[model samples]
Target: MVTKTIEVVNAQGIHMRPAGMLVAEMKKFPNCNVTLKCGEKTAKATAVMQIMASGIKCGSKVEITAEGENEQAALDKAAELFETGFGE
Candidate 1:
């Protein structure tokens, strides 16, 4: 598994649009399993509802984990998105 932690930078946090975008991007890596962890909450990265429900706010630190084939790539992509504030 590949793992990385990033602080959300988007002003609005992981709302509908960003959650949808994250799910869309994660769906591309069929061979990998991606998950997000924030405090005591955890959610599947491919589930938009779960992501938004996690209440990950701006400046919140989230740990991303990707396992299986293409794990590294998947983690990298997630990190890029988080670092870029989901292109807000």
Candidate 2:
């Protein structure tokens, strides 16, 4: 397993829109299993509702973890999304 810490750079955080986008991206990596944690909340990366429910606002610390065949790539991509503010 591998993990990366990133901040939510978007002003609105991971609302429904970005949650949907993130979940979509996560779903593409079938060989990798990923999860996201913010504060006391943790959610499977493939679950849009759970991700949005994480209540990760701007500047919030997010821990992303991935394991399996594509763990490295998956973690890297997920971290990039957080760094980019989910494309704002």
lDDT leader: 1
Q: TM-score for each prediction?
A: 0.97, 0.95
Taking all chains together, the TM-score of candidate 1 against the true structure is 0.97
lDDT of 1 by residue, 61-86 (tens): 99999999999999999999999998
State the lDDT of candidate 2 residue by residue for 2-69, as single tens digits.
99888888998889988888888888899888999899999999998888778889889999999998
The Cα local distance difference test for each model comes to: 0.94, 0.89
Model 2, residue 10: distance off in Å is: 0.6
Candidate 1, position 43, lDDT: 96
User: Which RMSD values do the candidates have, in order?
Assistant: 0.5, 0.8
Among these predictions, the greatest TM-score belongs to 1
| Model 2: residue 83 alpha-carbon error in angstroms | 0.5
Off by over 4 Å in 2: none
lDDT of 1 at 4: 98
